[model samples]
Target: MTNAAHIRLLTTLEHSLDSGQQVVSLTNDEDPLTLKDRVDRIERIELHFPHFTDGRAYSQAYLLRRRLGFKGDLRATGDVLIDQLIQMKRTGFSSAVLKDGVDPADAQRQFERFPAFYQSDVASETPVLRPGALEKPE
Candidate 1:
């Protein structure tokens, strides 16, 4: 989604809440707006997907990117699937941690199969039908 060489894939993480790192980990129910006051100090935010069907993180990611203007790494953690990578990127996730046994190579291939999308998304505001729409956002 970032048009980077490849999608960032992590095998695991130790939630940063107790470590005092610049990372913030939030559950699906947590409001991203609560972090608005200190978002600048944060370097990365990990949003959890308790279940594959639960998608509250998508809205949270949108708020962090569009409303809060967070430019740091937005990672998807827990129950992440290869099929969800595209939408996750479109919704503002910069990286994802694949569930156990999920092959990163196969996950990366998903992007190669669909290099472009027709509709506008968080990564690109312009629709492909419009001129300069495919240009990756800075």
Candidate 2:
């Protein structure tokens, strides 16, 4: 697996596509640009949270799905924990690269622990909630 920590923006990514640097861009808390702006230009984006306590990356992933409509590969690359994998997939990440010293098998286990469609928006054959509950009270 590639070391995501080594990934960097060699130049203003939007302007330097021809550089062919095999670069992967990451966004931290100070990024002024929106997820849409970043994803629109780059082929891949890694969402980086300096610590597990910081959750801004989750919101960024949510926006990438629900707002930005980014369809390319989205990855979680810093301070990642196995417990977060399910939630990360729910937020639209396709893959995750764990922090240094974490086992790759553990990361693979995170991907396989849940079914592919788990927590997705696929419609069910039967509604678990009563239809009446879905309607406003008159």
What lDDT does each candidate get? 0.84, 0.57
TM-score of 1: 0.84
TM-score of each: 0.84, 0.59
Q: What would the per-residue lDDT of candidate 2 be over residues 72-135, giving only the tens digit for each residue? A: 6666766777677667766767656665566655555654555445223311233355457579
Note the residue pairs that clash in candidate 1.
none
Q: After best superposition, candidate 1 residue 63: deviation in angstroms? A: 0.6
Q: What clash count does candidate 1 reach?
A: 0
Q: What is candidate 2's CA lDDT for residue 81?
A: 76
Could you tell me how far off, in angstroms, the CA of residue 61 lies in candidate 1 after the best superposition?
A: 0.5
Query: Model 1 Cα displacement at 56 (Å)?
Result: 0.4
Ten contiguous residues with the weakest lDDT in model 1: 11-20
Off by over 4 Å in 1: 1-6, 13-20, 131-138
